[model samples]
Target: MPNPCFSPALAIPAMMAALLCISTGARAELGGTMSSEANSIAAAPQTLLNGALRLRTVTDAGNTTINEYATNTGQIIAYTWQGPTMPDLRALLGRYAGSYLTGAAALAPDGNLHASRVARPDVIVESGGPMRGYAGRAWLPAALPPGVTASDFH
Candidate 1:
């Protein structure tokens, strides 16, 4: 007879709970490693590192494109996202997510969410168009790779 305290039903739920924790905990951070980056997003991205910098690009099922750039040292320094809907900014920005929130909130005090841009010394963000046509890019000025320009993000 199986132990009453360890029923098959209980075991299945326990296994699922463990998996949930593992999956969420694996989310990538701006200054984290490549392995973490691969697991952070829903789909695997094509990655290339040219000794000086690493670039990873992913196009989701909706055809939304997200590009992540990292340094040879493995720290994610910049990200560019353009798609039907804005990719989750918090997941990409890490510690700098709060800065974007604060700056965006200050835009359009009259309650217009269609503002063209939100610019700050640390974070520069711009988005436009409707939900199906949304597009934007956010980056940390201090984090950009040397000799790499903002326009290079496209």
Candidate 2:
């Protein structure tokens, strides 16, 4: 007897592709469109706040708040995150996380990884935590919209 629940369309290759999409969808970041970034924030418990300049704020799990700055074209140009715990950098920084790690590795080793700010040509990340208190922000310099200052993040 054949299994009715099993179909060739749902085979390992197809399943792999689906899984790939799901994983990749969870890592949207700066330079991605707002629609594409939605899935990343959906994984966290968040409250949306609308503001001027088409800006959108998403307060995620814990005290983390992510400010997404979009261009006139509605594409996400930059993102800022701050909270009691550092939100997932892999999800927030996307491809830029690797560069962050590389920068961090070259730090002065002052025993303050969280307190240090890692800067790369493309991505800039700042993090600091004292026990349960943590705060951080990451942004893509090249992607930031014109006249959008870094101070706008907080």
Candidate 3:
């Protein structure tokens, strides 16, 4: 029997509380000891963090932010880094891509995750660290406008 006094506001909070309780009890079954880094990474947005997208990034003098966006599950939206020069962005992402995920994951340096996106790897970015306000090189895809090109697609 449905409660006559139930409201959307009440239902939402109650449902959330129930879900939380269920998940908390199930953690042991999932099987893993918690670590500070793992917790942070898990808690941090898989798509966004502190106003920055996960994979897209822009850097200043002391910090860099990598951000990427997603909707529902599929159809990804990319991020853009503001660069003083195209080459600078390219160099940043070039090093970043080549050194970070690819080296560890051993994947290709595939920049510009989207059809309209552009990225380069300039430095080896650590997977776990203090994010945001970090300076980084710019990233503008493999086929940048005018004179820029990937050069080595081998």
The model with the greatest TM-score is 2
Which portions of model 3 show Cα errors greater than 4 Å?
1-43, 46-62, 82-154
lDDT of 2 by residue, 1-154 (tens): 1112211221223222322343332434766665523453443222223332345667666567766666655655556666665556666666675676666666555433235566689887665555456565667777666566556665
Of 1 and 3, which scores higher on lDDT?
1
Q: Rank by TM-score, highest first.
A: 2, 1, 3
Worst 10 residues of 3 by lDDT: 23-32
Alpha-carbon runs more than 4 Å astray in model 2: 1-27, 36-53, 111-114
Query: Residue 56's C-alpha lDDT in candidate 1?
Result: 75
Clashing pairs in 1: none
Q: Residues 1-154, candidate 3, lDDT per residue (tens digit)?
A: 1122211121222222332343121111101122212232234234333322222222333233333222222222322222231112222232233333333333332331211111224322211111222112222242233332222110
Of candidates 2 and 1, the better by lDDT: 1
- For each of the candidates, give the backbone clash count: 0, 2, 37
Better of 2 and 3 by TM-score: 2
For candidate 2, the TM-score is 0.64
What TM-scores do the predictions have?
0.64, 0.64, 0.19
